[model samples]
Target: MSEEKSPFVVSASWLEDRLDDQNIRIVDAAWYLPAHNRNGRAEYEAGHIRGAVFFDQDEIADKTTGLPHSVPSPEAFAAAVGALGIAETDTIVVYDGPGLFSAPRVWWLFRIMGARKVFVLDGGLDGWKHEGRALVTVQTTPQPATFTPTYNGDAVTSFDAMRAIVDNGSVQIADARGPGRFLGTEAEPRPGMRSGHMPGALNLPAGSFASDGRLKTLAELKTLITEAGIDLDRPIVTSCGSGVTAATITLALHSLGHTDNTLYDGSWSEWGSRSDTPVTTEPTPKKDR
Candidate 1:
């Protein structure tokens, strides 16, 4: 297996050594499902990495859509990051409570918003705490910086585009939900939503790509993607329950040098809630691409 470290992921030790660096901005981008029964903000207030600021995934999102944590507008994103004292040039490192869950969403957000030096801390705050790293209850108050956003519109797959893709199989849909949920054999966590996968959508649960809060090696990732029947040479569109864990799939794909992928921002939250979209319980048969 290839042992190459991902440029988009940084070790906890690397972050600890540069915690005091002026240009390094650490973001506690922790978020949890209601089912997890943990408050992200309250946890941050209890203690966080020194100099780390909390990034509210729900608040920083596009509020007009009423979708949970939808992508925010470029202008809104700029203001949000700027207020958090992040600049376009800073080396932004994002981490969540469970390592690889929601942090990659923020990493994807920054990259799509034109922040080039963005990264996700390997083995999140939990791992950091396990290593006996010191945390502070005191919140960081940084001087606001100017962040000009150059949003990449192509990085986001819209509802209309997703519809077209589903109808025509123009792009392979890689879903990050669990096998039970994807196969319609389990109940959805959200009420009033239909159960099942999209027609021709491939199951690539986000949890399979990481272990112990760290993403697996490139060779392992490749093996998993292929095992899921995803063709790396073709275009891919990632989706999850609410578009959060989908970025984990995106991160894994990008780490393997696959660039032709877009995230379906609304994900199953929108697709399963609506009556217009087609839903299926039949799984796609595995075959060589």
Candidate 2:
């Protein structure tokens, strides 16, 4: 197994060392399911990492799309992030309340928007607090910076592109939803959507990629992907309930040096609702397991 470190993930300790750097920007990208009944912005206002800005998933999304949390256009994203004092050259570290959950989405967003040196903070705020790291309740507001975004279209998958991939099987589609949802045994969290995965998509829950909030080792990650019957060499597109956890797969793939990957921003919300799109309810057959 390869032992390469992903440019997309950084440990809490590593970030702690650079806390005083003026050019380094940290963002708290915490978001929760409606069922969780937690407000991300309110929690951030209560307390967060010192000098960290809050990235609202809903605010920085494609507002025109009815799908939940779709990726915003490069122009919109650049403006939103720029308003938060982030520039193209800043070393960004993003974290969430639930360790590895929402942070990857922000990490993937930065990369897609052509920001270099972007990383997800391992273990998120939970990990930092677990280690007794200092947090501040007083918000720190910085002057907005000029951010120039150069969109990398290849890092994102459009609904039409997904339809083509589904029909042709040219790319591997991986769903990060739970087994029940993936198998259509449970109802989708969102109303009016059917449960089940995209045709030919493999079910690999995003939680499997992390333990105690930190990402698994590269060897373990490779095993997880291979065991799921995914061919690392093939192009891969990851999807999940909305588009948040799907980024966890993208982060894992990036860690393993698989750059030929994209995040389906519409994810299940788009695929499961469209009657013309193919859906699968059958369990993935095990090979004599």
Best by TM-score: 1
Model 1: per-residue Cα lDDT over 1-289, one tens digit each:
4887577999989999998899999999999988889888999999999999999999999989978999999999999999999999999999999899999999999999989999999999999999999999999998899999999999999999999998888899999999999999998899889999889899999999888999999999999998899999999999999999999999999998999999999999999999999999988876622
Which runs in model 2 stand beyond 4 Å of their true positions? 1-5, 286-289
**Residue pairs in candidate 1 whose N, alpha carbon or C atoms collide under 3 angstroms:** none
Error of 2 at 178 (Å): 0.7
Best-matching candidate per lDDT: 1
Determine which window of 10 residues in candidate 1 has minimal summed lDDT. 280-289
Error of 2 at 105 (Å): 0.6
On a 0 to 1 TM-score scale, where does candidate 1 land against the true structure?
Answer: 0.98
Task: Show where candidate 1 strays beyond 4 Å.
Answer: none
lDDT of 1 at 110: 95
Count of clashes, each model: 0, 0
